[model samples]
Target: MSDVKRIATRESYGKALVELGKLHENLVVLDADLAGATKTAMFQKEFPERHIDCGIAEGNMIGVAAGLATTGKVPFASSFAMFAAGRAFEQVRNSVGYPKLNVKIGATHAGISVGEDGATHQCNEDIALMRTIPGMVVINPSDDVEAKAAVKAAYEHEGPVYLRFGRLAVPVINDNPEYKFELGKGIVLREGTDVTIIATGLEVSESLEAAKKLEADGISAKVINIHTIKPLDEKLVIESAKETGKVVTVEEHSVIGGLGSAVCDVLSENYPVKVLKIGVNDVFGESGPALELIKKYELDADSIYKKVKAFVS
Candidate 1:
């Protein structure tokens, strides 16, 4: 894992914006005075005129993005997940979501991976909040490749889009030529019949590793990477659930209303199955190293392996 190429999804968000800016003249970026931390500074460096600094006012930044969208500009409102989704909830919901504007929210520094920033900055509820919006499309990319692809997809797709990115540098898992990204589609990383492990964001890699460990213990664990939470790939999830009978959801979010809850919603309605959710167990994250916090919250590969093994047994 150490030798694997690693890049933070936040960095990919910035670089992808640069690429998109070159192609789309109507593309505009707005930031809440944290361009450097959010990595939107890369876009500002290249297209200073096109990038708007809203100066720490996330709600106002969202409003500005909404206005830009109405004028035929593809506006990407950039900020940390805490500020973008949490602080600017009302503006995002009413101004962008209710109107169904073409506003793309590039929310970086999501989940417990935010490290020393503590629970206040580590937004584990962004996906849940975004999911509730009527027309908002929620996307949580797994890695650099997926993050870049998701950014481009958000621009191509019309309507309000909430893209969650992480500060932690994760291994590039989808670098293969055969890898193709589609909105509202889940990628099956590894197939098995015992139990299905549905994961999103940075948890996808950890879930895959856990599957490998589960295999050694004679358990056949299927791994599915679900990038899009809202408008979830219900077909794939149902099919996997039917085959495996048991399910486990992994996410770098709270077990309350994030990916786990979304998965539960689908399964409970269509196919009833026992699901063990692996995530932040209804607790606030304290200040700590990002990696250590992940382990403490039982979101790391080893913890996932142990939890899944016990559940299966």
Candidate 2:
């Protein structure tokens, strides 16, 4: 186990992209003119020749990325969550998803975490949108460590990958950087039986905190960090739901078609449990601090703890 630290996953992308650029000369990074914000500027600085800025045209950027992927070059396309998923959806589906192109979409500024940017810039629905695209592997890492692992894994994996991370720093729970990352695996952060809290992205840390609080309250909550939303670990979810008899799904994204919906889908087909979902309630978010925005949408640990108590009681 590695000593977990507190850092935003987006910063990890900035670090990992630079590291990757140093290792592989063929590893090209494409940015939709937001290299700095998307954290690809580090790569650009390190490998000026390999990094391409497509000037905010996300659709064209995806097409170029797909073309590069076909030529046996690993391309990490960087952009905002909403533009990458919304503007490039068709191109991503046909060019990348259909052919299973080895293109990594490093989407930053996801959810209400893009605080003070308002609803238009906030992309709480990115997860639900990207997860539905066939052949696209959706990964929402909890912190810097997991983000680095996911970036490394996505580079070697052959297919379309959507790696979403938040803008602000958060508590890191994953201690093992040397730990191998599996594409469709879920990690159990804490063991319990009273209730199971399945979470992804920034919510994973929140879930861990919630579990600790629940433990203090005499509620043994099993917390699972569901980094991979697409190709979800159905077996783990079903088994956890069975053991707990009640489950809570948490994420930075909207409740619909995101981590919560995915977990519910698995449970609904298998062992049905009383589920309480903690996320953005299908609404756009306004400008504020990231933590405040999360609290506004009830995506905080205290909310998760309270909901779990209600469900388990």
> Which candidate gets the maximum lDDT versus the true structure?
1
Provide TM-scores for the models: 0.99, 0.96
The residue-level lDDT of candidate 1 at 50 comes to 99
Assess candidate 1 and give its TM-score to the true structure.
0.99
Candidate 2 similarity to native, TM-score:
0.96
Q: Where does model 2 exceed 4 Å of error?
A: 1-5, 177-180
Residues 219-304, candidate 2, lDDT per residue (tens digit)? 99998988889889999999998898988899888899899999988888889878888888878789898888788788888888
Name the top TM-score candidate. Answer: 1
Which tens-of-lDDT digit does each residue in 229-277 have in candidate 1? 9889999999999999999999999899999999999999999999999
Residue 269 in model 2: shift from native, Å? 1.1
> Which clashing pairs does model 1 show?
none
Q: What lDDT does model 2 reach?
A: 0.87
